[model samples]
Target chain A: MSEAVSALNGQSFVGIVKIEEAGPQGMITLRGDAGAAALQKAARDVAGVDMPGIRGIAAAGDRAIAWMSPDEWLILLPHAQAHEGVATLRTALAGTHHLAENVSDARALFRVTGEPARLREVLAKLAPADLHPDRFGTGEMRRTRLAQVPAAIWLDSAGEARVICFRSVASYVFDLLSVAAAPGSEVGFFDA
Target chain B: MLILECPCCGVLADETELAPGGEAHLKRFGPGASDDEFEGYLFMRENPRGVHFERWRHVNGCGKWFHAARDTSTLEVFGTYPAQTTEPPRDIRDRISARRPGWTWREFA
Candidate 1:
């Protein structure tokens, strides 16, 4: 068992390790009934776009990205745009077979921008989502279990990737990543 | 262990998640209906020796109830779709329609 330690800030905790990997500037999760055609139509009408298909991700302008599912989806956006994006989706899906629950604060986002292969190796340890090019290619998204946590994962066209895990387990997953990175010794946190 | 496939959730789910809807193509008889209608409704069996359609619920998985067409003899799954969706791949729609004339083929096709 690892010894419990306190950080420089004097916060004592168990298994709360610092993540040296890049971190997302922002992220959000949206859950609801994706099968409702009326809700989908409303979302398109309000967001001026339709949600992406399963194993796919679509960006709504420069502000948000909506990932699809059989009965739910997660919408990711910049921190600054989170509130407005949720508001728009809510108003659009009103009075329909839909329920959009905001879970931005519930999840912690991690951004990986350097050493793609190394980052992939670290992620493979805890992610059940297929990260293969054929399956998850650039701009694709998947909702899968990671480190026993439900997560949404996606990669931008630029090859930068983002992974979101529930806040409750973020510290544990961060520790796991830190250990995985120890082998390659390329761990570092993002400035942003 | 009868391997049942679910429409909403793909194959490979526990049978416990499903509640047997009994041999597919059930006919219902009302008070004004005839004796033949009641008998057919109570105990009629195509006893399809080959392929048959079975309704199943993906309770433990997607929780969406749906139907599947499969071969009882060979256990070859034809296809599956959402409940009330008019598109099942195999010709089970024709078989179901042929057995009951008044039944709406469009309803469960």
Candidate 2:
């Protein structure tokens, strides 16, 4: 059997911000009425997080729910349990208008970790998203263009950010982040 | 350089984040219609140098289509509304009227 490997083979870069491939994530694309009680329960039971508000992301331990669109959410869980997670959600929301599909292998993710200000500076160079700590904080996610590839980012804490993009563009995004986070390239744009 | 609000995501997105979708509120003339009507429908578009309605997709934000009313020359956006609405909301129309009195774009005045 062919074993699965992370898109970048766990490549990592140490700079102003530590950029490392998040190996083997369990992701599910769940589409439904975010306000529906059934969905709220299903997600809470499965991911341990309630329905996030607009552009909101809530996490508890290894489980998370991210508001993707008006009616879509991305659920994150343990890498080994993605397929089982989808079956559980579909069974729970069977009667409702909903969709749950495994997307763990279809996407790539990276964790940018360092001082909050330095991490924000690294992202600001490659994305147009407002990186001001006051404006964007923990529990909020922004779907925006990173350099040129479409990517979504969320700050789990003041010092760490998680970025996700299509699997095919993982290397491209990694390169962009590496150059943006290079030690001397710091523009100090986000330093308070 | 233009930043427009997306009603779907409720965010002001940069022009680079949006994809222009041309004029909005076009009446479709299908196969049953005369050639002139179809030609006008397919080819004729509002090109007023002043107030105009346009469709835009927030490609990088929420990925939803929305409408924008703006001045062609000045690039001043009167307002933006959700794509589901058939016509500009009263406030958007009234705002344009207040700023550009007697201005007409297609059937809107």
What is the C-alpha local distance difference test score of each model? Answer: 0.55, 0.90
**Cα lDDT for residue A112, candidate 1:** 52
Stretches > 4 Å off in candidate 1: A1-38, A41-49, A60-62, A185-192, B1-109
Assess every candidate by TM-score. Answer: 0.53, 0.96
Instruction: For candidate 1, give the lDDT.
Output: 0.55
lDDT of 1 by residue, B1-109 (tens): 4555554534344455456565554656889999998998888765565556667765433456677776667766655556774356446556544554443332354
Q: Looking at candidate 1, what is the lDDT of residue B75? A: 67
TM-score of chain A for each candidate?
Answer: 0.69, 0.96
Share of native interface contacts recovered by each model? 0.00, 0.55
Give model 2's TM-score versus the native structure: 0.96
Candidate 2 Cα errors over 4 Å, as ranges = none
Per residue, candidate 2 scores C-alpha lDDT tens digits across A85-155 of 99999999999989999999999999999989899888888887777887788989899889898899999
